[model samples]
Target: MRAVPTLAGGFPDISEMTVARQVHWQRWLAAAAILVVLAAIGRAFVNGQIEWTYVSRFLTAKVILEGITNTMVMAVLAMALGIVLGVVVAIMRLSSNPVLTSVAAGYTWLFRGTPLILQLLLWFNLALVFPTIGIPGLWSVRAVDVMTPFLSALLGLGINQGAYTSEVMRAGMLSVDVGQYEAAQAIGMGRLRALRRIILPQAMRVVIPPLGNEFIGMVKATSLASVIQYPELLHNAENIYYANSRVIELLIVAGSWYLLVVSILTPLQMLLERRFARGALQITR
Candidate 1:
């Protein structure tokens, strides 16, 4: 402690106190234990049966690159489709009409209740139910030809994503004050126009975080399409391993790519959140 004299000679001296830093022994012990465990795991993997050469050699293979490209393409397209569907379904769910609400509810229930892999399989084998699908007279095509692995994966992943995304959208819209709706109506704006011009913009800030996370999930979900023969990263990795019998190495390569993608996307998501949160009192940084 240090005493400082006040400007007024008659005033008592003020004592300056120093804060003592706390040493958390428990925290140090926990960190040391975790480091030890991680070191052990790393050593095991380094000495394990996985061939590092195979991982390095195939990481940038043409097929692997193509597969990652396809994965990103599918993720973007599917998320776009999901967002469109989710917005529409959320509007329908919030509608006053019983029929629209019921239909939207059923759509969400049906898609969300079922397993995504089953949906992919069903879409892939649509020919079993409908041999041909097209306009009655203007056009026609075999279902088998139309429902390729790409289309199957798209429909399966997009529709499932929509089911979950609808809830996120609905929550965001609900987060807005009801007074905002009344205020918009007072300005002679129709319900849809009010939503477009006022509500949705404000809701976007609240929704962006969840939506970004969902997109990351969608990127990983592309792997599920592998079961339906979609040539995504995991599928291509599987093919390489199947041929070379280097399963762990190929999986590690694929995982590293996935991690790289997710890492890149994380910063992008933060940027998007900040963009949407502009003008708000507390913006996401």
Candidate 2:
């Protein structure tokens, strides 16, 4: 067979049309394959040969509301105490005194070194250290009564979170240019004022994103309080499941509430971060 060649003004001969068609078909086939796989997965979930009913039932109004309340309380309390402790530690770390610096370092080392679970357990059983804890001349409370699961969990989680947060804050403080400190001093700003007015404000930009992440983490970590019988989100869910023996359902309940809480918190954190970033970034058309 003679191969036909196109001349000027004549229809040009096209070669490899089959190759282009093959490429197009290959793309179509790939898309079809993906769609088929997706459809099968959706079918499996919808038919719930997977038992989604139990999960749905577990996400009742009462369960969800309670979980949210408990979770929020735990996260907020932990963050509140942690932040205050963190600031103090950051200050100590930045101080000129060697003893305070060593003390701050030791605190971070001890708490961050140990697992939080162990710390919680220790606090829960703290009465063993001293059956009574109070001032000798002042009013007192029994260690056994005062160190209830709730208090133990709070103290353990808050203190441990504080230790970790301290390091994060310290790093942020240190990251500020040393010249900022000198400039503040040159302006006759006292140490505390320089830190609060000048250095800390700048450090907040670096500190906040990680701090948000830490808050989110604390929400999950509150679940660990379950071991001590502290009635946080997961513990309450567990208690419900045990009573009703709807293990998977109650877990789904807990999971749903957690997802909702985190979802809300993430957007708020983003807003705060944007606010903090003001003047640090520029806008474009």
Write model 2 residue lDDT over 84-194, tens digit each, in one string: 999999899888999999999999999999999999999999999988899888878789999998788889999999998998899989989999999999989999999
18-133 in candidate 1: lDDT tens per residue?
A: 56899999999999999999999999999998789998999999999999999999999999999999999999999999999999999999999999999999999999999999
Cα deviation at 203, candidate 1, in Å, is: 0.5
Scored against the true structure, residue 159 in model 2 reaches a CA lDDT of 96
What's the lDDT for candidate 2? 0.87
> CA lDDT of 185 in candidate 1?
92
TM-score of each: 0.91, 0.82
The whole-model lDDT of each prediction reads 0.95, 0.87
Candidate 1 displacement at residue 163 in angstroms: 0.6
Model 2 residue 201 CA deviation (Å) reads 0.8
What is the Cα-based TM-score of model 1?
0.91
